[model samples]
Target: MADLWTGMVWPVAITVVQILLIVVPLLVAVAYVTYAERKVIGFMQLRQGPMTVGPYGLLQPLADGLKLFVKETVVPSGANRFVFILAPCVTFILALIGWAVIPFGEGMVLADINVGVLYLFAISSLGVYGIIMAGWASNSRYAFLGALRSSAQMVSYEIAIGLIILSVLISAGSLNLSDIVRAQKTVWFFIPHFPMFMIFLASILAETNRHPFDLPEDEATLVTGYNVEYSSMAFALFFLGEYANMILMSGITSVLFLGGWLPPFDIFPFTLIPGPIWFILKICLVLFVFFWARATLPRYRYDQLMRLGWKVFLPASLLWVVLTAGFMVTFDLLPHH
Candidate 1:
């Protein structure tokens, strides 16, 4: 019994450590991403952002978090009492759950299931439920409208995103994220599938409800959208959830197209720097791209956004899928070594 328990103890300890690895960094990044966003946008618009909080506004997020921590929790008079409290929790959980299967580095995944990609897609899809519930439970037209728009937009782009992922999965012949990264050891998929990468990036922006695609939360129209009624820690949960999803999406992009945690090349003498560094670098780059897009692009008109997703990205991804299939068959790139 002692021997058996000893063998199991290390596995359980390792699992606890793995869970901490996922949760801790994510929480810290969520705080800092808000800071980074303010700084980046401030610089872009020729204004100072969070100058008073610590040197160069490094502690602005911390100050903001402290403020939210003490804010009052106000439940609206007519809302569904249960779901009104639960909606943000649901959104926050779904956001973090997707990270469970994401391989941060070589042999550093929390729960590397065989269907990791599928699990991500499914969990992401469930995020809409949280938005929908928040809107419906809020008993506000603006909130309802925002929820509806966000759901529709997310669903529309998700189809194209699914197709884009399908193309890569076909090329790599596996749904496991680690397998996908390993498949890119010789050459990343972005080279042959540049169009797919473009489509995927656009769809991700839409899915995450980021700027230019942030129609649901359009301040001019929806007045802060679904979480309009939320206050205090409830509001903070939604905020943290959004940033968590952003980081998770960036991690996915890194694993899929940026070689997961693999360094640029193995030629460097300092090969001992754990794979997590490369993963972090790639995620930062993707996040910067998100910030850059927000800084540069104007929001799309509703009709134009819908048309682009349905009429443009959908067809483009579909075409790429077929083209990739034909190329693979013709050139015999399938059965990838």
Candidate 2:
């Protein structure tokens, strides 16, 4: 019995440690991603951001987190208490768990599943449920409407995103993320599939409910959207989940299009840096574009957003998938699994 207990407990403990190694730093990164977003936007707008917190505002995220920690969690009088509370937790957990298959460097991933892209797709699709639950539990028409909008938007864009991933998978000849990255050794997928890459970037922006497509939380109409009744840490969880999803999507983009941890070139300077560092730098570059879009782009009209998803991205991505398969077959360019 002791031997059996030790065997089970030891592996469980090690697994817990591995999860912590990924999650703790990811949470910290999520906090600072907010800080970086603010500072980046501040620069784009020619203003200082978070200068007073601690040494160029390095401590601002900590301060913001502490403030949220102490605030009163105001549950709506009519809210379904359990689901209302569970919603943000759902959102945050989904955001974190998607990182399990995201390889930071060669052979550095948690689950390393065969269908890693499918896992990420399913995780992202489930994210909308949290918003829907928040909207329903809040008992607010505005929140419900926001939830409806988000569900429609996310569903529409996910189709296009999935098709785009199919195109990448066709080129890479594997659904395993590490295999996808290794396939890009000859050239990043983005160069060959530039149009698909641009569409993917836009799709992820909508997928994360970020700028130009932030209709779910549109201040003009929805007044704060789905979590309108949430406060304190509940709200913070939703906030953290958004930034985390942004990073996750960027990581997926890095894996699919930019080559997960590959240096741009095999030259001396690029190769000297480690693979994980290259992966991180790629994520940061993608994140900067997220911030830049927020600073520069106008919010799309709801109709325009829907049209782009259905009429533009979906058809384009579907056509690309077909073209990619045909091209690979015609030219014998398919990577051997």
Candidate 3:
């Protein structure tokens, strides 16, 4: 019994505790981010947002979640029940598993893997699986079409994203995210690599299926698209996965460009606050852009989205990578990993 407790139970228990520490706060943040989106977009659209849910609609997410929890989960008679049920689970899980490598602050990551950037990219790329599964399982034309559109879009943007990340990796000279953040101590990557920064931002929007680039589930045509057959908790999981992915993408952007957890100038007012606070603020800034784009821009047609990814972003990012490397090599500015 003593041996079992020491060798097995305790480690498992401790791991669970540590996981809860990250997960609970994360779930809470996810809930409130939904609220923030509604509030921000509503303000942008000149309307009151969720005023009746709680104190200024503060409790709306909780209420909505509960409603979703109780609603009936309907599986189409023609659908593959197994894969239909598994799709959202896959989405929710993959969206979360990537967080393992994310460094929230100095020494604040769950797993400080050397190839953290690669891990994140791989997980993000795999997110297409959930969509494809959902589409095929649903046995609905609209869902299948939406899924195919999303898969193609994600793949296209990912290529540009890969090149942009390669540029950052070349500059940082390491695959570890913490090292990447610390590499920005002298000057944030965005300052020097502003063009790549912009490209990265645009790529992530398409990758995460954000507005203007969200052709997969274009409400006008697809009627909710790939998840059209989902309802109740099934739909809720997809919703959760999307918002979670948004936050994760924002975090990745901050880590890559905004100097994750680093004070702006290490000066009096800037360094006065804790690192995690700066990280959170940067995330909020990025997320606000997500909502802002939704409110301000119109949805793109699938062809336009494809053209932007392949013709515009792909070439631009590729060119910048070569230029960045050449410039660094010529100047002897490339840092050693």
lDDT of 3 by residue, 149-203 (tens): 9999999999999999999998999999999999999899999889999888888
Report the Cα lDDT for residue 189, model 2: 94
Query: What are the per-residue Cα lDDT tens digits for candidate 2 across 9-109?
Result: 99999999999999999999999999999999999999998899999999999999999999999998899999999999999999999999999998999
Query: C-alpha displacement of 169 in model 3, angstroms?
Result: 0.6
Which scores greater on lDDT, model 2 or model 3? 2
lDDT of 1 by residue, 1-337 (tens): 9999999998999888888878997899999998898888889999987889789889888898999999999999999989999999999999988988999777788887889999999999999999999999999999999999999999999999889888998889899999999989888888778888877888889999998899999999999899899999999999999889999999998888888888777776536777899899999999998898899999998889999999999999999899888988998888754
Give the lDDT ranking, best first: 2, 3, 1
Candidate 3 wrong stretches, greater than 4 Å: 1-4
Provide the TM-score for each candidate, comma-separated: 0.95, 0.98, 0.98
Residue 148, model 1: lDDT of 94
Considering summed lDDT, which 10 consecutive residues are worst modelled in model 3?
328-337
Task: Tell me model 2's lDDT, rounded to 2 decimals.
Answer: 0.94
Order of all candidates by TM-score, from best down to worst? 2, 3, 1
1 or 2: which has the higher lDDT?
A: 2
